[model samples]
Target chain A: MIILIDKKGFVLSLDAAVAVVLVTIILMGSAFFFLKTNETFIVNMQMLRVGSDITAVLQADGTLDTLDPLQIKSGIEEILPISYNMRMLINSTASSSIIIVETESAQTNKKFIVAGKRFFYAVQGGNAYPSAVTYEVWPK
Target chain B: MKKAVFFTLSLTMFAFIVLSLSFIFAGNAATDDARFMELASINRIYDLDTSLQNSFSKIFSLDSEMTYTASTTEAIFQQKIPFNFTRLNNSFNNLRNFAIYNDKNVQVGLLPNNVSLRVSQAGIVNWQNISKNITEFMRTNSTPKSYSFIIDFFEINITSCSSSSASGNFSFSVAATGGNGTSCNQTLSINPLQDASVEISLGTKSLTVLFSNYSASVNARDNKVALTSRINYADTGVKPKIFLESKINITVPGLIAKKYGDLRIA
Candidate 1:
């Protein structure tokens, strides 16, 4: 018995293999890049969510009624991500005042920051008062 | 034939890697979505709790106005306390909807499996009219992870009137148990006998007028109370009405670990 190989067919097969390898490499690179970029998006959204949640909790517990800004600021700091920096401000319509509840810096971890704001009603002196609280967050 | 077989194997390996990465990315997305829903649900509960506190404050403030009618010496001074029932109902609905939305997944459970509203009043008067039924949501302990809310409403009433004009004294007081710890009280004393009308101010915009005939003895008072004189006062709990103290307590499954990403597993 004897076997014969076609040179043209062998060359075509080699080219096809090379193309497949190139396509795989491109696919792998793009997928890795996409995942890396999404991490930033996720972190920003998480920070904003944290701010809105803390503000809503403080308002609901009647802590806002005390007219002391520090109470809510401290609460936000407690629930927030440890690596993130935060600042809170309360704007009151009744008193026409803007109060800085609390502020902190994450120091070296301050890159890629985001902020969130929320509005809610607070009862003071037997009347409903509307207030706006803003939260600024950054990874530490 | 050998080259063909090698090419087929390479393509299969590449496809598998891509598919696995896709699945991992999808899982992460689902976790983020679940976390958002959880945060939203928590915010709603907080708002509802605050609304409950405000309503109680308004109701208590209106109680002061009840004192205005006492000036006539009526056997029964009845005044209905006005509260925003619609707002209360709306808050309750929001709370229920968010709770369901936040914990719909099988992975999430209502730790205690029940919600309750408990009312503790100072008196035994039938308060069904002023009270909202809470037994409907009450439940016992259960396993599958759950959440429950306990609302406390406290009421204290004080009423006193004297028929004698010989320097009599009347006092009334009501207190709030928690959350700021504030108490309110009123005291009035009439000097030696005189055929004069006495005015007593108990709260913000609350005043009760007492008419006395200096010569009439304490035993000559009649059971009938004349509504001839009406004094309008701001509704703040003063004379004899329901005084409410409310607090919200929540019990739900929680983790000692402080990672937002862990909510997916929770």
Candidate 2:
């Protein structure tokens, strides 16, 4: 038996190769779409938006300057919605760890977190202190 | 061969359509991310603005306005407060401690080079050229937005005999021993931002004309406040709504935002 090679089959081979590549890409794209759709995208985005708004309101009223855990906790509680829970971690030059303020549910059991970090300066004793405040929000 | 070629072309076209659809959806996602980031960036910028402003006031207030305890003394600025581009930038940078912020590959960070202060009051052309003695100290302040000035609004050098009473945002009675005593009640409008004067002569007897907060306060007491005491004139430098605006640009991987917001550092 002699092996036969046909030059005319070249285009057919090229098409098969191209088709294989296309099919793989389509599969990968479909997988990505399905995976993405399964996740809580809107909730996470809402969390981010909520976090941003919360920080803005806190910074606006000069409440961030106090650096008091209790005060910050109250401020967050006032701004955040009833359904969401938030925890803030503040780091300033004046103290190694100034305060970490959070709601009860924010620290509890399960976790789906969206975090935003903001840089601000707080006035402490006639001097301004630069601070990095991070807010993490999760749905209750 | 023809059928194979047609099939390949058809598959390529289908792939292109899928990719285009993906891009359209991806574009919307990018927009959402930008919106959220922008909102956050603006809030943070606002905080930074107030912080810088409050810091400026604190520094100056420590020097003059707030108390006289440590006048001309602060870690921020030495000798005189810097108003130039370079010095002010240096001063503000010295005030903050952003460990590794605005560094390479930072997804969200302020571009340090892009942060700049506009010290010259907007309306006053070439304010940078003005000296500290005249611009900063002598006159309280006059800006495009608002002004409260402590300027010598009137210079009355009475050379001859004259009895005169003045009105309009201010009032003065010069009991002249000898002025151009034509019994002239001059109704003059005062615009201190510009060089303004009413020369009334008190006959070689030197009279000290003092302008206190009264000029500004009276002008403020009435909106478009005119003395209108048989005289109608309004010259109020807008009560000096002082604010220091800085242009700062923040950047993410794909977005660049230039903020010309008022830092309110005054």
Candidate 3:
């Protein structure tokens, strides 16, 4: 018969082990969040760039005096491959606007108009911050 | 064994959390991008519209002033001359589109296409080939005391590409009456002149009117009187008015009593 010693009175030092486990979990969580945020930022940046480029192209085309629709489309296509969803609306006064993804796609909607010499904002989405870049079409 | 189990569970949770966060961030980024794109597109359209409106306004203003000057000149000519002088000068540098029609609804001369008003008339002489017919009439006429003339003017059309192109016609008609009318058994030389009323229907938004009146005595002993009127309409549907008056004394000696008068409106 062996006499049982009260080794239960001896406290186990779990500091190193617990510290490692905690560090691992924290590292994993942080990495996951960082990667996600980075990806989102990149995608947003790309989309913004594309949209701005398209706007610039349309303005540069000036008024749609040329009866050649293909010319205009080709000109825009040179800069960005327009999806089937992309559409352009021209007004009787020789102004135009392009509408892209639907509200369902991004949970947001926007509209703009050309007033006098400056670009005026008509609408903004819930998630969008105001832009600082103001655009204008010079007199012909 | 328990420790191993707990560690394994923690690892799985961490992996799941990371995966979910990544998805959320990605989705957010995509959403933001779309918003930015839409806003930019709108701004472009707005800018274009503003520019077009401003240009149109300036052009319209200049056109109104030019029309006034042309009418005033025509009125003065009719008063001084015995013959009916229909002023057909409607072409202006700022007008993109213009048209002219007579009281009988007949289109006389179209500018920038059928005729170039810029060089059509050299003083009182017709320079363009199209006006050769009118010039011949003026040369052959010895007695201008009994005659009628109609003049029409219009502006050129400008394109969206900022190129000047041909467009719809805007016209004004001037009718001058000069003849011998018997009143109370007395033969009186009467020269009745009518100024063409200028009407411009640019679109549903704007309308412009120009009118003038002038009268003179055939005896060349009386004073000549002329009146010019201009009106411009804007968004409030109210019309703005401008009027000018001029008087001239004639000293040409003639025994025959001759009277001249004219009225015009569109």
Candidate 4:
């Protein structure tokens, strides 16, 4: 029979609880957005790394130096994962470039794409020739 | 009422703090990610540069090896240098996107016109065309040690004056002079002579020499030579994937010898 409660205190407590809930909802929304963007960024970085490694190995093996398409194809096949698609643009001159090699995996409609480029030296006709190789990669 | 206000203020402050901390962490994560990517790109560039340097050194080494072996006669040179030479050539064919821009006809001496050898990936060894190119280049440059082998004589007989069609891979004219100062121009063929004695008279002196018992010295000056070389992988049917259309100026030193001599062709 001694149930004496302060209406003011009850009202304050309820209001505080509502504020906390709203703030929590906002925090969660922002965190979700940020984390999702971070994941996407990380994926792109990984793609870039893979592309760079492929070009480096080809250059080191003298396959890039000779412009051997068959060897280059085999090298790429060994390095790239089965789930990814890759295309290469090879050009001798900076201006009026040409598409030397282009390849894609069985899966199409890739959701993400990244590209990396590097220059390599090629010897042909008893001369040293310089060329630029660009690789475009994406997950299937 | 005052307590309620205070509670609301504290809750708002806590939420802001949480939000601010998360933003800061996100920023740091983004910055770290960008930095990592930049570092990776730089590393790749360095690797590519190093690879190019190593390849260049290999090419230079091959060029030196060929230069040192130039003293061997043409036949030996042809027989031995193809393996190393093909490797040298294969290096050129490996680049897929390579371009060479040699606008000026700068005489890159590595493939000087005087060095007659053009080997394609199809395993075509055209020595005669190469010889013609080299002879013209040497004549233009007036380079010393520019010797050519136009003909090789294995055996020949001249019991009587007779002319026959040239059947050997190479043909050349020979000049003979007896001790008596009588000089005669003789033609030698690669076919073995059949039981014949040759006589030459010079200035009131005649020397008889048996064709079968004599050794011949062969010298070529600005001559064309042709030989067929089978590439090991030609049967594999792998065509050259890349053909470099650009003209680059690459100076390969000591690619061709100044002179080749002392060829005793039996």
Candidate 5:
């Protein structure tokens, strides 16, 4: 009825144009899928950022120097969001490194775990000592 | 047939373009992950440096170290700086897989002995006791201007009295005497040091002399940024997450002074 076909039964008009356009669409769709953001990695980075910020807050407020695990624990809980959980470990040259502070049942296995740490001087037994604070965070 | 060939060729070109774009996107994603891990390691390295500096400064304020002459002061400061470095190194060795820390990752001064105090942040304890003593001594004396208090190596002399106001503002001047005087001549920066921070109070039943940087002569806030920080990093058997064992001699910039001349109100 009005097919645009060449003498050799080849499509040379609208059909060819439509085929080219369809191929372009498929390629574009695949490109988008390929470029879909790696959100898991981004979330991990964000979790690490939150962990670092909490430690920074602790150090800034001077609660870290007290070496009182209770004060440090409360300090972390006050700043951490409700949707996430945290666990803090303190390591000092004066003492063995251990989990000094934590949120409610912060299990690292609940989700993908992101960890962060901080370092500073804290006085214990009348001596200023070097100490490291490590924190692990996960979504609840 | 020519048209078929042309359409096929066009499709192939589109496929190539899309594949190239995907690779570029993937490459960006990888570098970003590496960059974040790098950033975390660098932060740890910086904390290691500050711990060493603070330890050095705190030693000067120790009751044990205060009795030394200038030579002994230098000796003690030099000898004591190594105390924290090894402990910190071993503690940090636990995190090497993160590739942000390793053995001897952060160094202050020189390595293998010769660790000098890059920035001294010694603080005098029993401050409340000393300040109260000074105020009480000055209040009862007929000529208050002649009053001076010496704590082992440091002397606080009160003179050139304009007037004695309430206990809200104060100032200090320090000059090193009878030694090499390596760093005592530099204008003091008192710690608990949030810039332009802290109120030094001296009080009695009726009189108080306070020192705040708000006054003209107290220790002005100064911040030091160390750019020569070299961090050694190595990680192997991981692709794109980190590089092969390579030395990352990065010149860390904007490292703020951790602690110096701490004035604790004990």
Candidate 6:
């Protein structure tokens, strides 16, 4: 009788052990899920800040005068604590259409005309992703 | 009894495993969030750069004629033939540390309300501090020229600001090249070959500009001067980044017609 009782007690304990193991597995799974969600949220926030700065700098007309390559570099350096690298490029593009303006002369049969007003400035930059910024300007 | 002891031990191990896993997952989540935020900020900067470029293009298209007219008495005109030294001085004041080099390579430090007695056809202008003489020269001798204008922008790193050192130590440069007149044929070329260049460096980031050159050629009998231009940029920086470049081109149809006549009547 005593042996039987001991045997029954051991089986019950075994069942309890199995139940505890199951609970631990569930806890670990939950923790992983929480970690992943939080990470996604933080990344999104960083991206937002970067976008804001870019917009602010570009929208500033007075800032354009200050768009010296060196100054821009400095600005990036100022913001480097945030872990971002910045670059800018302004190039003239051959993609242009000629415009011809003609005027009939009042004094003679000759007409006055102007031509060759085709040219563009290409502005491009690279970040985590490659992007191009183009500024087109005609002759003065 | 042995069976009971074994079962108890197994349950304890299981509980420990569960707790450890949970902690690991939680820690990972936080790290992931940080990484994501960093990437987002970088993207935002790029987007702004793209938008700025688009805006500049629109403006350039609307004002393809890069001409700005000012009377002899106009502030810009009264400054001089080769440059409006006064305006240049003012512009430098707005920048943290400004410097200019003329064809002669003479460095002229521009100071607020300051004037210099040195007289020359072309020389450098440096704006390290404000001075009285520099101001006078800008008002009296500065002149606007008919051809190209070289504008430089510098960025100074503000390491620290106190009574001892008010300004930052580091700087980077960006230049805008604009041209006018009959002799400015190469300056206005639209091809990539005709563009000029400026060197820029910020910390570890660096790049070079190959300005687009645009050119237009008419009959020798025609009075209109030929024009050409080229513009180009390349990334020599550590990471890919975006930036904005804005330029305005104005063409005075009436003025060109009066000066060159049929030469521009293409």
Winning model by TM-score: 2
Each candidate's DockQ score against the native complex?
A: 0.05, 0.16, 0.05, 0.15, 0.11, 0.20
lDDT of each: 0.39, 0.46, 0.28, 0.44, 0.41, 0.31
**Over the stretch A20-108, how does candidate 1's per-residue lDDT look in tens digits?**
66656665666665576567557666776666666666766767656675676676666767876677766655566677765563346
Which candidate's DockQ is highest? Answer: 6
lDDT (10s digit) by residue, model 4, range B1-266: 78778877787788778767667656765676566556545544443434334443445344423321111112122222112344444444443224123211111113222223322232222232232222111111111121122211112221232233334422233344323333445454433322223344322423332222112222122222221111122231333221111222322222321111111111
- Which scores greater on lDDT, model 2 or model 6? 2
Per-residue lDDT of candidate 2, residues A71-124 (tens digit): 888998887899998988887776776578889643667777777666666777
Runs in model 1 with CA error above 4 Å?
A: A1-10, A37-42, A105-117, A123-128, B1-266
Error of 3 at A36 (Å): 2.4
B1-266: candidate 6 lDDT, tens digit per residue: 77667767877776787777777777776677556544443343233323433433333222222222222222110111122345434333322121111011112223334322211222112111122111111212332121232322123221221111112221111222222211111222222233343333333422232222221111112111112111111222222121111121222221321111110100
Model 6: CA > 4 A from native: A1-22, A25-140, B1-11, B60-224, B229-266
* DockQ of predicted model 5: 0.11
Ranking by TM-score: 2, 5, 4, 1, 6, 3
Number of clashing residue pairs in every model? 19, 18, 28, 19, 8, 105
* Candidate closest to the true structure, highest lDDT: 2
lDDT of 1 by residue, B1-266 (tens): 77666766676566667666656665665565456445544543343334334433333334223221221111112222332344444433443333333333212122121221211111111121223221111112211111111111122211222222334532211221212332222223444234323222222222222333211111112111111111122232334232222233332245222211111000
Distance from true position, residue B59, model 3, in Å?
Answer: 8.3
Off-target runs (Cα >4 Å) in candidate 5 are A1-41, A93-97, A108-110, B1-12, B50-266
Alpha-carbon RMSD, each predicted model? 18.0, 12.2, 24.8, 17.8, 17.0, 25.4
Docking level for model 1: incorrect
Fill in the DockQ of model 4: 0.15
lDDT of 3 by residue, A26-138 (tens): 65665666567667545444454454455445543542233234654555456654421133332221224332212122312342222111221111221111011221111
lDDT of 3 by residue, B1-266 (tens): 46655665666566566556656655664566455445444433333333323322233232322232222122112112111122222322211121111011111221221121210111111112222121111211111222222222122111111111122222222221112321111111232234222222222311212222221111111112121221111122222122111111111122121112111111
Model 4 vs truth, CA RMSD: 17.8
